[model samples]
Target: MAGIAILLDLWRKNQSFNAGLYSARTYQSTQFFSASAAATAATFAAGSSFASRALFGSQVAYSDAGAALPEDYISNIQSASERVFKNHALQYSTKQYDVQLKPLFSAFELRTFALTSLRSFLMYYLPLLEPRVNMEDDDDSLEDNQEDRHVDLVVPFKKSVIQIIRESTVVTTRRILERIAVHYVSQRMAWKILKDVPQSAARKAGRQMPTLVYIYCVSRTTFRGHMLGVAASWIVQVGIDLYRFFTSGFKTLQEDDDEKQVGVLAQRVSVAAVRCISSLIFASIGAGIGATLIRPSRGQWIGCAVGDLAGPVIVAVIADKYFHVTL
Candidate 1:
């Protein structure tokens, strides 16, 4: 019985020792789990703080870029616009002042003056040089009549030649003056007023503009461009008319009797005035029409000249037909 009791006590003590070892292991496991959890929480908090700082810095950079981008774009546009306007202004100024003129006494002009003088001389002098027959010197009365008639005709022929040459000179002078005025006085303003007829016509045609509109535009442009030319022509024509009137008046006063001279001077003056006005009007109209039709520099010149020549004839025809008067 004592041996059996000793064995039971040993069993109890072994069981208690096993229970204490289990309790210690449980406490150690719990402590390790708690420390691991605390470390994970601290790591998570640090990562969150870093992420927030990075996000905030990115937002600040984006906002700065957003604000700066529009300002930069606007500045670029403004600079580009300024450059374009400056270039346009420079080009306009250059084009405005660009003008070229021929020398005053150019070869073509000299030739023209020479030809005009020669033509005038020939027209006046050729009729006087009739194939003369060697007649007997004893025909005194016949010779005297021939001399009187020759004297009367020669003076007029000489004066007519002089008048033509003078007119030609005046025209040549006027052209030079006009060029000078266009270059120095009016400058680019005149060029703007003057149309480039062929180019303008072509542009208008491309746009399908009407013929009447083209004609009107071209005519108006021609008139504006040749205003000085027209004025010069009028002055010259009026001067010529005055000269002829005075010479004719003097001749009439000498030849015609007192009764016939009463209203003849006044009538001649009126005729001269009518002729001058008719010439100016018709000339302007002709130049316009010619420029419209021809569309070239030479065309305008030819038209003006033809108009000047035909003005008197047209006036005479109209007067003779409608008014029963000869100009």
Candidate 2:
């Protein structure tokens, strides 16, 4: 009976320990669930408060005066954009006129002045110098004397001829520049005229003969005027050189020793020459087509303008493909 009592007591102690452990685990689980529920409730309350504030703020904003007239606001923005575009177009047109047409015109004027001065100098000196003549003595006894005299005359005559050529080159170059400038200016004006007039009216007008005539006349007149100037400048330069050569006793002076500054003068002359010749050739072909066929009607003008702008690009392609030229 004593052994059984002892065994029973041990079993009761084990059962109590197991019950205590289960109770402790149940309490921990319940505490964890309560804390999670409280956290969930707090989160829900915060979310609801945020939603209410956002809804109220939206209502208040809509009720304000600034929130209305969305279409008017969009239309105003569109109208402002259109105005800006129009302003930009006008400014672009003006810039094109100034940059494209004005510089060419100025160059033409300068070329004319230089050519005129050259021609005047030439006319003044040619007759006085009698540059084309070869004087020979008829004294048969002095054969060596006759030969020396002929040589002397030939040298001066040769110099005179060279002077004449140089003068002519300047004149020709000036004429070309002037012609190009005139054509460019007229075309620019034509563009403005078309833009100013109503599109329908301009189309109905078809060919503008008066405008064409104006362009031609201006080109011709400017060319003639500039050519005269170039001729004069050439003659003048020649005269100065001749004067210096004669004064120096027919002795050939070193180019560096000369006060006439031939190198700088030559460079200027070359620039004028290139500008005139290139302008003439380009204008005769390029500008001629642009003004004649392109300027007659609006459609023609548009086509011509596109072609004109694209001309350099076309030439570049040709040069690259055929001539192996590159930039």
Candidate 3:
């Protein structure tokens, strides 16, 4: 019995010790699990906060932080292009109008104008020296045809004289206006304005192009070259019209009638515009045909001059004959 009791005591002591150890372990494990859970929650919260902040920062960077919209980009491009065009135009004008650096008149211009006037005078006078054509048309091949002879020789003579005077007056007026322009504009600009259309056309004809394209190029070149002369002629015509309008007492009576005045001005402008366009078209055609036929320079010059002179007459004749629309 003693031995049995001793064994029981040892067994009970071992069991109590084991039970204490197990309880301690269980408490430690529970504490560790709690700490782990807290650490994991804190880490999760920090990660979530960081992810949300990143998303918000990215949105701000895209929306309001130095980011350009499509419209802003296009506006920038347009502004840059406009600046470039403005600069180019300024540079070109500067080069063309460097008046202080160059003389207004040169010997070449004077000689050329003199030659032109002399040639024009001869063109008119030489026809008089030739045998009087029985027919009015110079192209009439049958000079021997007595049936087509003019009965009134005095009328034809008067007509010739009037034409010569008219031509001389035109040349003088153009020269005077050209010199006046030289006073305000640069020599280069003035020269360009008065440039020979035929010479320019001849030069441009070197390039091979379709017939229609060639004609168009010639016409465009001629128009540009003759712009100054056309403008001067239009100005003269407008001045005359205005003078007549004022002299007729319309200005005094209709002083308050701004609409009437504007209408008259517009009508005059339209007439001038039509005439100018017709003259240019005819001149361009002449230049092209002349350049193609005769020696480029001489042919172009003669053709252009003839076309410039005859264009208005032809238009007038056509209007009177076919359209009954007097210009």
| TM-score winner | 1
Candidate 3 residues lying further than 4 Å off, grouped into runs, are 1-196, 208-212, 248-270
lDDT tens string, model 2, 1-327?
223323433553565555566654443443333333334333333444445536544323322322233555546555665676676688787434432223323323657656655665565555555444335655664676556445344555566566555555655554455455556657564344223222322443355447656345333333332343444454555555556556663464666645455554555455444444433333323332444444433433343335434544655576579988541
TM-score of 1: 0.49
**Which regions of candidate 1 are displaced past 4 Å?**
1-94, 99-109, 125-160, 172-185, 189-210, 237-277, 291-301, 320-326
Better of 1 and 2 by lDDT: 1
lDDT of 3 by residue, 110-202 (tens): 665566556655655565556654545555556545554545556555666554444444545566666676788768866666666666666
Weakest 10 consecutive residues, lDDT, candidate 1? 1-10
* Model 1, global lDDT: 0.58
Quote the lDDT for 152 in model 3. Answer: 53
TM-score of each: 0.49, 0.26, 0.42
Going through the candidates in the order shown, the clash numbers are 0, 18, 0
CA error at residue 318 for candidate 1, angstroms:
2.7
Cα lDDT listed for each candidate: 0.58, 0.45, 0.59
Superposed Cα RMSD, model 3: 24.3
Clashing residue pairs in candidate 1 are: none
RMSD in Å for model 2: 26.6
